[model samples]
Target: MSTERFVIIGNGPAANEAATTLRQRAPQSGITVFGKETTRSYKPHLLPDVVAGRLDAEKIFASPEDYYNERDIQLRLGQKVVQVDFNKYQVILEHREVVSFDGLIIATGGKPRIPEPLEVFEDVMMTLKTTEDARLWIDRLARVDSVLMIGGDLTSLSLTRALINIGKKVFFIIDAESFWPLPFNERLHQEIHARLREKGVDVSSSRKIKRLTQLSDCSIQVETDCADFEVGIVGAFFGLVPDVRFLARSGLDIDRGILVDENLQTRFRNVFAAGDCAQVYNPVIRDYWVSIGYDNARTLGRIAALNMLGGMIAAQASPESIFSLNGVQVNTSWWMEF
Candidate 1:
């Protein structure tokens, strides 16, 4: 039996896929998955459905309760990896627990990017990045009749539709800057505004947010250059940034994310990064690109695992660029097949 110990840092699609692939290829390998979230991996795309009351919260889980146990995978939930010691081949948990590994797969995923103007008021800003965030929105929505959404993305669009479908008033400030990496042309921006207006959304053209004031009734007052509005909550959906703060000192080539070769292997051959947290090299472009979405994450995870096992399989470029949104073609990296 091979005694190779593998460490995967994440509990999302990429992390789970890597673990499964590793277990299959190396049956006797010691595999441990560290998830910051207490819950198991779940479909983040289905979160809007849960918030809209269309799907049950329990149905979001991507795997069965005993999936890891059946596969003999060590699953450590709620343990945030604070740092990685590449030289020592060790990972330090938040509580300073150190675990050594022969192979390491980093699939830390992305975190919600809060707009610069609203950074100070992040405490009151609602974001839908995980199941927990969705549950919080669901609970908060029950008490309010209207919501103010700042910024726009595929997730934001879906959540807006969900909110409207549930008979809640939505005031949207369409920020083109939120759709980074996605070509947000003026024509497309205007089209989004038109579509949102057609869907009964109070679409505001203003992009500048002056201030946010918390009201005594547990509501928020948004002051924009165009108008002032008060709502139960302010949702920020400015896309995502790599959640690689923990690896800041790991000495991995870091741009917006950890840079990896076409084989998903870092400069250190034993280390690999995949999913949203990895900026992979695109041979065609001769540049690095960060691929998002569930499909891309799963594909990259599998490729990363294969390369970790001494296979030289290059990752393909993400094929998800444009998706139809209610008859409108929207360009985004966050598109899900579902």
Candidate 2:
């Protein structure tokens, strides 16, 4: 018998979990994980801490170096898969390196949305999606006394709170009247808003940002339909859309994301997708969503690995509930916004 070769293209929770499960399911198999980001796989919730300097990049790894070494897994960091040869079972990386695999997992995850107004100030405004993004924000913290956040998703809210805790005044603007569009009791959502307000977040809902202008002090002044607000830093967290732009040439099923079955396997039998890059339908609850958060990603990744090994375990869908401000809620995940 010959050992199987597995390749996972991503560094988030899904890619990490899939590689780990593959190692456990087939001890003799060679597992490789390729990540576009150079940083280790850390919890998304810890990104705010990374930006605030509360946790270093090395300390925030969800699956640190030891985990990979203990499982005899290979880590390929800072490598982007430019193309996939479905006919040959090979992937071409940005540097023109070609790697072959028997099974592949596409856990490319999602990218943050940038508003049209902020596009011109590419050097000024920022989005928090990777450790590199956090590093950029952290580098400017010395000159940033306040932050203007322009979304109400989990990423935006968490960064707002983290900045506030670090003594940076935060001004938040959202399209909706409430906070995250989770299944929160209206009262709970109001309570969450009140708590954020008490903690010094200047939140403005139902507002539209027209454009961004540079003030005399090099700070960013947001021009909205209602009024103008100036801040030393500007960040937007309009949540994420699947990073499936690269898969267009692959000819796989893609609508909102790479469509996958209950087993997390894609149309191509050897190729699977998980994490924010996958849109799955759960037969148990008869619900469909673009999976977000770490827990759901892990579940799909594990299920993908099992299905690859001819196991019959189905991907379990994590329930979407009200996201808590104090980090006490479970089954919490965010869907598409705008």
- Superposed model 1: Cα runs more than 4 Å off: 318-338
What digit string (tens of lDDT, one per residue) describes model 1 on residues 1-338? 25799999999999999999999999999999999999999989889999999999999999999999999999999999999998899999999999999999999989999866679989888899888898899989989999988888778888999999999999988887776545677897888888899999998866588888989455888887777878998899888788998788788999888899989999886899999899887676667777778888898899999889989999876435533322222223454321
- RMSD (CA, angstroms), candidate 1: 3.7
In model 2, the runs with Cα more than 4 Å from the true position are 115-123, 177-192, 214-218, 284-287, 318-338
Please state the error at residue 37 of candidate 2 in Å: 1.1
lDDT of 2 by residue, 137-169 (tens): 888777868888776667776777779879988
- lDDT of each candidate versus the true structure: 0.86, 0.76
TM-score of 1: 0.94
The clash count for each model shown is 0, 0
Model 1 score (lDDT): 0.86
Model 2 Cα shift for residue 31 (angstroms): 1.5
- The 10-residue segment of model 2 with minimum total lDDT is 322-331
